[model samples]
Target: MSLDSISLEAIRKELLDKFKDEKITNIIQTKKYKIIMEVKPNNFLVLNGINKKRDTFYIHISIDPSSMEIYFSESKNTEETISSPFLNLLQNHLIGGKILDIKQPDFDRILHFIIQPYLKFGQTQNQILIIEFMGKHGNMILLKENTMIEGSIKLVDSNINRYREILPGKFYISPPSQNKLNPLNVNRKDFFNIFYSLKDKSLNLWKLIQNNFIGISLQNAKEMVLQANLSLEKDVSNASQADLEMLWTSFNRIINNIKNHIFQPTIFLDPLSEKIKAYSLINSIQFPPCHKRNFKDANSCLESLFTELEKEREILSIQNKLDQILSKNMLKINNKINDYQKKLEEVKNCEKYKINGELIKANLASIKRGDTEIKVINYYSPRQEDITIPLNHKLTALENARLYFKKYKKTKDSWEIILEQLNNNQLKLAQLAEFHKLYKQYSNSLPNLLKIYNDLMKLGLSKKIIVPLKKQEKKKNKLLPAKYISQDGWEIYVGKNNHQNDFLTFKLASGNDIWLHPKNIQGAHVIIKNRGNKQSPPLETLIQAANLAAYFSKAKKENKVLVDYTLKKYVKKPKNAKPGMAIYSQEKSLLIKINLPEIKNMISQNSQGKILSP
Candidate 1:
């Protein structure tokens, strides 16, 4: 869920409490969506401004989006960011400045950080970093003297938006106001006047409240109705005096929390999927009973939630790309098959041409010059049926027969070549179909996805997936696997990509080591270190390794997953096989449900022999 206005207010207060008056030692735009600043006393503050469909609202201070950072994180994927002039200017103007104050304008999901520039013996110059978290309209703009635009991360012109144009040298303007009443500023008389003024019968109680209130969202408005012991579907005219009293009390209670800065940052998780579902500044009592975890502040909650969400989104994005390629290739194959079938139908009458040629030669004397046709008996026909042979009047009879014979030969030869080409294309289509099935079945497995992408690149099937030589070299240099230390101190390694799977299985693992993978499912290749003990891992260790295999597979969200485990000695990599493809024997299957939190806790206890991070 996006951060609502109440949450943004809570976050702005939290930032002021933590970072007020801190010197900005450095400023770097790690990416267009992210900005990193190093502060005095060793603090890294991140301003993530990604404004995409799935990721609509995130304006918080965190480390980076990829890592699980308790404090802050500097991004390691800086090479992906293109250097821009706007970023350079931000770095030059903001570095060595001190944050004087932070403000969230009227709980509008906007933040302005007032910075005092460092100058030698001069009056303080105030600059502002305005962060607007208004869904697709979200942007970060830097302003000088709070009026003139310095630069913006994104520039909007009259072509993009006529209401507001965010460009350099255009006097900065705040977004147009909705003219809704601020819940905190509304008096009891004015609050009641809202419902009294409403004459639209279609406006329900929930809409009435949300439309009148400045910061209340639809969900929050629903919560307000529940708190007031009233139905959200209740019409505004149906509210009794007692109901109005309850509604007024409830509205004040909720708004008072935001006004007084008493935010209890809460995140709701889906128990079945073990993924975060929603977050809010206040507890959501109207929601169904689920796992609710509260954080000390809003930023910490936002960071933790967005980081995990970003991981899932990244996997989904790659899956979508591969799906598109598969769909296009499937269409191409179907069209080719259709065209070839039509060609085959057209060539089915090649023998008729030969018959015409032979009959014309035998009955040449019957044909005269300037004749368009010749009536003759087809000797080649089983019944000696009379046929009208078409004649090329311009050519001699013998030449006309020769022309038919040449046409017959050419059509017969093309049929043979077309049949051969069709067979080859059919074979290719089958291979692609199999890969498409695997891709759909194991969309969440990064290793499987990378292997499929690599195969598509080699086959020239993917038009968008470009594998640069430098990236290939970099991947070769770093073959990091998902490493976890078991309670028995045995190191367990799980492959995250195709090459890592091959390296872990063939080179790093010993013959006696245990290999685990999801049964008949695309997943990571997991290896449990035996250390020449030549014996099976303990049951607990084996289960942990098996769980990793299932957790990293496409079946991660399933209630129960079956994982197959066997000795590495029984596993064999076929010659010229695709990456991460192997056959094995002497395997045992284990059916179990994976508990993500339990596994995460177990892995977090160990600090050594972990290769998941660079």
Candidate 2:
């Protein structure tokens, strides 16, 4: 949720107080939408306004559209930061600068940082950095002393916003004024009169208050409804005198809080979704038991809320991309499978051509070259049924028989080849489905996501997932499968991706080893190493390996799961098959009532610290 002007006002006051004794030390561009300014306390008299090591903090300004905010955080994480042209220009003018003053023009969602840069021995200079927190139109611009635009993080021309353009060499203009009445100045009489002056009384009271007030958001309006205990959906026309008085009292209370600076800086979280339900400098009320967090200042409150939001956004973006790539490739594969099946049906008619050829051969003496049709009986059918055959009158009966035999031979040959191709496509589709399950088990993981992204690149299904040149060499090494050890000390390995599965099944496993998998489910391939024992592993060892398979499958959450186990020698990779595809025989199924807690503990104890947790 984006901050309203009220919350921003509180944040501005909170930051201005802390920054009075501080100066900017550095400016870091953390991500596409966020920047960090390292600030610390300064001793202007002793060190030419250079900052000391004490009282250092970061001013984090974010313009992510979803959460446009500027707040002070205790520490800065420069791990993901990279340099940009704008960042370098900002550092040149902003570093070592002290905020001489901060302004909120017309009490809008904007901040003007008037800064004095570290100058030469006798010269003086100042710069203005304007940050606007308008949702979906947020921006940061550096301006000259006279408000001439120097640069901006985002560019808008006449086509984007005709009233004003933000570009280099243009005079910086303020945003258009929202000519709503200031809530801080409204009295009870003015409030009632304003409501009555609007001829349309059919408006909802909650929306009416928001439409007529400056710096008040929808959350503010909803909070008024809760505090006044009035009907939340009541229209102005339906409201009694008592309801209007209650709303006036509720509205007056929040305005007084703003005037007195009695802020709560609260974040209310929905219990079910565990996400921020509402954020304001004033307390919020929500239904079904919300978790309320109160902070000493608005800056801390916003920092905590948006950190969770940013993480959620990053994961969602990756997931949507994975879905898009898979959807495109899966659709292509399904179309091929459909076409092959249709061709198979046409070739299945080869038996009829063979029957016609045999019947013509049996009746060759009775048929003449001028005959157009013939019926033969007492031949191929046990009951001697008659079969009608259409003939080419210009050709001899013997020649017609030869043509039929040739057509039968050609169709039968095509049937064998196309059947193999169709089977391979079906097997590849199944392998992809299994790989999707493994991917979801670590959807929030960066390493797993990159590994899967690399896998897709190899399969030629994803070209848009870019890998940096620096990491290209490291990506050449394949990701190892998840490894574990059984109670009997047999090493077990589970493959998290198709390539890893192929390596585990054929390259790493011995012919006498035991293999286990979840039955009819998308999951990992697990192998229990025999380690040259040359004998069968105990039943308990088999169960432990089977448990690993069930835990990693799509059915991991089920109370009861079925697992299939077989010898490695029985598994054979089909010709022209995908990396993970295999045909196996002599398999046995294990029905398990899963002990989820036990399985989790076992994983933590035996997994060799390689499980990629989401």
Candidate 3:
């Protein structure tokens, strides 16, 4: 969800307190979505309520259209990077500058960070980093005096948005306002006056508040109803005088908190599902099942939430790409198979040509020249019925017989060729079916899915999955798998890609180690390091590994999936087999339902949301 204006106000206050007068020592743009600013300490280094020992400041700008965030953070996950023009522009201007002020303009979800360069006395200049946390429209723009746009990470032209074009040397304008009432500025008198003047008394109180008020979200509107001890579903027009008074009092109480800076930033998480649900300034009393994590500052809250959100979005992006490639290939193969089937049916009648040839040759004496067709007694038939042999008018009877024989021979050859092509097409369709099955099972396992997709493209069996191509190097690269520590303290490894699967199953796993995979399903190969012992894993640990197999296979959506487990020694890679393909022997199978939420929660709580490299 986008941060509402009230939350932005809280963020503004937090950043202003934490970063005022600090010089930006360095700048790092780790990815398109994240930017890091290193700040030098402004005073003696005793960290407590606000200031910390850390020197880095983070601004995460998500490109997602539904939910976007640009908030202060202490750190972010380090990702591979390439040179970016926008990063260079930001570093040239923002580095070695002191943050002078941080403000949210008119309670909008835009943070204007004003800074002055640490230059010679005669050359000092002021600049602004305007972060718009407005979903798909969200962007980071460098400005001179907050109006003239010097540059932006993203360029908005007339084609993208006619309302405002953000470009170099152009005047930057605030997005058009909705003209809703600013909750902090509206007094109790004005608040009551709005409800009293409402022509629709039957409107729900929560809807009315959300529609008429700025900086108030649906959750906050519901909170207001709770504070007033009134049902959110209650009609505002039918409310009693006492109820209206209570509501107005509650509304003022919230507005007063915004005015007095009484912000209690909280991020609500569902522990079971392991999902970050919502955030608010005031402590939420609703959502009992959700784990409410109160933060010392909103920056920390936003950092953790948006970081996880970015990872989830990345996984979704990979899934979408896989879906597109698989769907495209599947549709193409299906059409080819249909056409081949029709050709096979048409050529199935090749025997009729041979029969005509036989009839023409047998009736050669009875048939005359210049005849289009001739009727004769059918000696080849079981009942000896009469038969009509079509004749070429210009050919002699023997020549016509030879022509029919040639036609029969040509169709017979075509029928054999078509049958071979049909067999090859069916084989390809089966391979694609396997790919689709694996894609559905392991869409969440991005690394493995990507590996499989690359393998398909390499074999010329699937369309190329478009990705940013990296410069090739003359080196032998190692593959990494998803690592998790089991509840029994044993290390478990699951392959992310086909290369990783081969590496895990053949190179990393010892003979005595345990191997697991979803039975008759396309999924990641899972291995449990057994310390070279020829013993079975604990039932719980075995189930845990099996769960991974199920969760990462085509059977992920099924109620119960069969998972096969055996000693690593029993798993064998065939010569010239496709990547990730292997055979196993002496395996035991378990039937278990996959609880993805529980599995994900386990991974997060145990592994700290990090997949280890092999």
Candidate 4:
């Protein structure tokens, strides 16, 4: 909802109440696009309105407790309570006079503020004060009885006529315009008739007001619909009597609400902190509590908050890519390792290499005769000398041995490097897997937290909702669990992930705080605690928090899972560790598949509006 209509209506109602019986004293131009009128009751009603949605321009009305001061401006001057060029003119000329008449140019649709007042000059006779309010097409003129003293004009002279003709002893009239609407006589019924009769049947009430109604804003039109209890898009012609009656009731209700100063303002949520700090006079039904970063801090922070969420999503994308790359590299290294092992086995199984020792011993005698090249000529050596034959011309024995040794060395060295690389790849893949696991846990936890925040806000405790800051405390290794608490003393703490299961159990927890988590699958670490031993909570409360944790975690929808629980003092966060990672000892696990309907019922029965159920 826009605040413009609400503020304007409030000011207008106030003025109408104060000046119901008062007469205008005098009217004068305070400055360009500004005017002031003195009233008999000595009370000035300042009316401020902004035509643009931007905050730069504003219409202001100031009323003094004793002798009211009415001022209006669209300038961005924050120092003075009431300051405007129009107001300045009114103050100067209409301080102690009375209004004579008001005129409207039917052709130009221009409103003129005319006043006759006794002046201090000469004979103390009445002088005319003329001011026009018809946008840029209108002008203001001042006259002394029947004679014009001064006039505001677009041009001083032209090829056809001189502007001085309107300076003195001249009449004033508005210029011509093709389309116009008289604001003074416009009514709600006329608005309905005119808009309903238009060719565009899809036009809603707000659209009609924006396009056809003179001086009526879209915000005001929406407010009117809300007030009348009539759907803005409902066809007026087809509306039943009952609908019309309801519409009238709604309209009256809104009008009454405005008159009685009952307005709910729109709370501005901080995108960075996801907290609300300021409010405007606009009616908004819901407040989105959790906001993201990386958005422009304009009139609304929602856009920026979404941008932050998008960045997180992008991070998730990058993480997935990294995981894929690591997986592919690990697979490639494993394949190479397998190939090297096969090659090494083949070399070891080679007949020549395997029988080389026996062959050398048998040929020892032949080899010692200075016969560098020798070959066995018999199937079985009857005698070493008898089996000897000169070596053929293809290759020498020493050269063959050297070549085999060289091949063995190359294979060994290559295999070693491949094995080492494979081992390193496996380690890296493990680390990547761990990283992906933790990231998923963190991502899952965020939505649950946001849902909790929203639910809390609905209960009107939005101001109390806070984001947990990361903190580290070093002591005698005592456990400190995480949890959320309500104003009425209900508490819930979720763990970072499964790695923190032990920490959530052994440290950071008190004996009194209830522990809740998903049954078996890896999920958030949830702890519901009582700050003191005030009283033991009901079983339903524990179940509700547990169900939420399971729903938000990686667990698929199953009948039941096991959830372990212990005191916060039992759970401990390890040093130099990732978020949501913890250690816990001597913990008891509960096998409870999430019963969403039952848990919801229990939440409704126990906490109702006190705790956020969604």
Candidate 5:
């Protein structure tokens, strides 16, 4: 469910207090409808904090319908956020600003963030950012202090909502008001009078209170009913005067909590599905049995809630998009390859056409002028025998022979070109397909998935979702090939993706080191170090490295796989080839098979996401 005004009120307070001395350092539009603003302390000396605490945190604003929220996150998700004109406008005006004040006008689902621009030489400007949490009709608008619209995340013209048009230069207007009474501001007699006027005898407190009051959601209403020591099924008309007064007292108690700024933010998760179901600042008796986690504040609660959910969402989203890109492009390449091969086969018959032309020319004069067929002795034939030759009666034998020669020339000229095209397309298809398989193997891994995303882009595919190549590599967490220790004390490494495979083969392994790969199959390039200690690696080490190759390959599931092994010097990367691609000669093939559980044990020695020492 979306957040209600009550939760927004608590969030507004938390953010306002936290931003007392923080200033905006950077702002990024993290998605099509989301914006993240980085906030840092004015004093930067104590900038480092252990664990979840940080000197700098980000405020995430997502106008997305599913998880629309504005909250603080301890870390920024470097996953590619979109760049839009609206995002650019926001950065220009607000990157160097500080939060002057945060207000929730009328306790509605709308928030107004008043920003004070960085102080220049005796000059200052102020801007107000208004964001609404209304589902589907949600909007984020930036306005001048005088309420002129500067820009908006979503533009609502007259056709969509005639009452308000959120266009640039227009007056900024609040959404139409909900005519409900503010329970906090109203006296007890006034609140009771409104409840007494309800005509429906069967109206329950949870639904009816939510319908008639501002800043109260059905979740909040349910809690109010329970806090009153009233049944959720209690009807308005059935309540006596004493019951009404008791309920009013209960309602006043909750209002006092809000006035006193007491909020207990907690998220409830379903024990079975393990997914977050509901979050509450006020406890509810109506909720089913749930596993609950409490937070010190609303921002931390929201961060954990939305971050976990968004990570799952983003992984699935990019995985599906990458699948589509790879599938469509690979199919196109495959079709081109098939056409080239088919044409190559047709062109192989060019020699037959030339032979027929030679036979026709050898007996050109023996053919009658109007004859449709003729028997001729072909000198070039191994058995100098007479052969029947087809004649085009409308043309001379010389003309027919010339036509055959022309056909032979065209096909012969294209054979080599077609074969070369076929080889190139075949190589591209192999690379894309190999990465697609790698994506499935590590779908939950963000760094590897992003690296795969960048690799696919290099292969000449375009799409909106992209992660820059350099972001995947960090100073303290450099990407490396999978490593394993051989039982004989040899160090073996296996490449996980094309870039790492190229690095492992060309940069890390030396000339005398042993190399292994799945023969004729797309898989990891495996290298065994410790070459200086021995002329050849032990049989046990070779077997383990071969199994590692097969495990990280397409043929992993098969009971047995053919693996090629040679000296690292013999395995050469082709000129201008794809990253993982290589050519090798003087290699021996081994039919390798190993226990799956055993190979995984050898790989567990090197955790992929382990932090590197500085």
Candidate 6:
């Protein structure tokens, strides 16, 4: 809903009324970087302006009883007391300047601060403070004696840039190619004409206001629309008689509601849920009336559920990434272990003759003298010049194999521990995947349950029947069963599902009442009481009852259907029978086509009593 011209006008009127009796007393900065002005009301502080052109322009203003100080990013480290150039200039002019009037350039667009006695410095006077905030674009302008002193601009000229100047010496100019709207010059008729030109109803009021005027948020536009009681779509130029009436009524109601309920928070709903809720309400008059669910609360629950699912998805993504890295590393480590084992085996298989040759080549005196039975020595060269040898009386190859086997055992032991950790991590990854699946199922089940309940309610069931279904239960059984009433006010029992069917035929129904069921089809078992009298059952009544059976049955779309009817006494529920499953004998079959509208009318009439209760 766009804020049309009419709504903007209303906002303009409101702002004018609010500030009519106020004056700017002090200016300060909010923690969020907004500029706030203290006015005469004393009870309220107006957010005077905002800095939008550059984030660097955020200046903190502190007000004390004795003096006011302004701090900017550049002055953070100065230990000596020094005034900000901008603050000093503003203070000198605005300290005692009496605000003569305040005007918005266009409704909530830009504010022109008109002050009398503009500060005189070296014969300069008539300084005015103009603050412009047009959403993405905003600036502050200072004018001394009608000539601009300095103003915020999108681009600084070379003269200003070279001199590092944003001061009173240079003249101020409006930004290039800026579309400015003067609100004071626009009248109601002009606004009406402009709004009427737009034909699209879906255009948001805030967006329209922002495009045509300036400086309006969606919240502010919505407030204006509420104040006007106006249909955001009603075009003044093309309104038909009916449209005019609707527009007028809506406008008046909205305005009155706003005036009565000032400062109340806005209520919003999910569109999808809202539509479903409406459908449920509309369809329930014909079917069993379902209980209404709070769509707002349901939407909130759904949002949280989705958010939790998203978080789980992110966690799963991280786990998968980690598992991939671990698997790659494990493969690399296993390959290294296998290669090292092969090298160790090669070392162990080294020939004893080669070792003996090395021992002879080293010329160890004991071996040469044959004093050690010509023992072979397994030797390792530490350097070209030195060799260390250990002689084994046994064959030299066996001794070398023993050393290689010892090294293999140590390396294998380390690898086994690493493999154990990998196996544990893989198990954890599988568990996480399972958890994600279960969470999704659980999240999905809630909406399905809600949909089923809503569908059932649209069938015209009373709250007495509907409320019990929402309760927690230990077993899958209905606390309250479905009951039907005959045209003569005789109570007839009908089963909703298999379990209820069993109960109705055996426990609830009388021996004399005729039982009804759609022949050879999945449907409710309906029993109509036989009022022992000469009067015959009206054809209409019989058809109505049959329609209920067919409507609730699998043969709902068949033009004609065979329904079995018999005494309740003939119907019997077997031991350990499932819901809606019952056996009966001595049944009479009647073929009749179902008339849904007539049955609905009958049910609706019967429900009047229940509806009037509260």
Candidate 3 residue 137 C-alpha distance from true site, Å: 6.9
Candidate 3 residues 113-212, lDDT tens each? 8999768556755999888877777888889874789898889999998999999989998888988887878887888888889998889888888989
Q: In candidate 3, which residue pairs clash? A: 441-553, 448-496
lDDT values, one for every candidate? 0.76, 0.79, 0.78, 0.47, 0.80, 0.47
Using TM-score as the measure, name the better of candidate 5 and candidate 6: 5
TM-score of each: 0.67, 0.69, 0.73, 0.35, 0.68, 0.30
Scored against the true structure, residue 171 in model 3 reaches a CA lDDT of 96
**Tens-digit lDDT track of model 2 for 206-274:** 889888887778878888877888777888899988998999998898878877777888777777666
Cα lDDT of candidate 6 equals 0.47
TM-score of 6: 0.30
Candidate 5: 10-residue stretch with minimal lDDT: 605-614
Candidate 2: where is the Cα deviation over 4 Å? 18-58, 72-92, 118-125, 154-162, 183-208, 228-262, 287-289, 294-296, 351-402, 436-457, 466-614
- Model 3 per-residue lDDT at 108: 72
Q: Alpha-carbon error at 68 in model 1, in Å?
A: 21
Winning model by lDDT: 5
Q: What's model 5's lDDT at 319?
A: 88
Clashes per prediction?
2, 0, 2, 71, 0, 23
Best first by TM-score, ranked: 3, 2, 5, 1, 4, 6
The numbered model that scores best in TM-score is 3
Model 5, C-alpha of 498: deviation from truth (Å): 4.6
In angstroms, the error of model 2 at 382 is 4.3
- How does residue 356 of candidate 2 score in lDDT? 92
Looking at model 4, residue 460 earns an lDDT score of 46
Q: Give a tens-digit lDDT track for model 4, residues 1-614.
A: 22233444433444444443345544443233333444554444444843333222122222212111222323333221335444444455556655444433341223334444446684554545543333333344555565455444332333535433443345643344435354334445764466446787565655554565444456655655655656667765556667655654554455455546666534456676544433334343233434422222122232222223433443454445434544655566567657756665655534343234344445555454344455554434355333333432454555444444555566567656756665765665565465445434343243333333333345443244432221111111122334444334576655544434455544555766666555455677776767667576666666556665776567747766667666555656689767566566667766667777764554455443222221
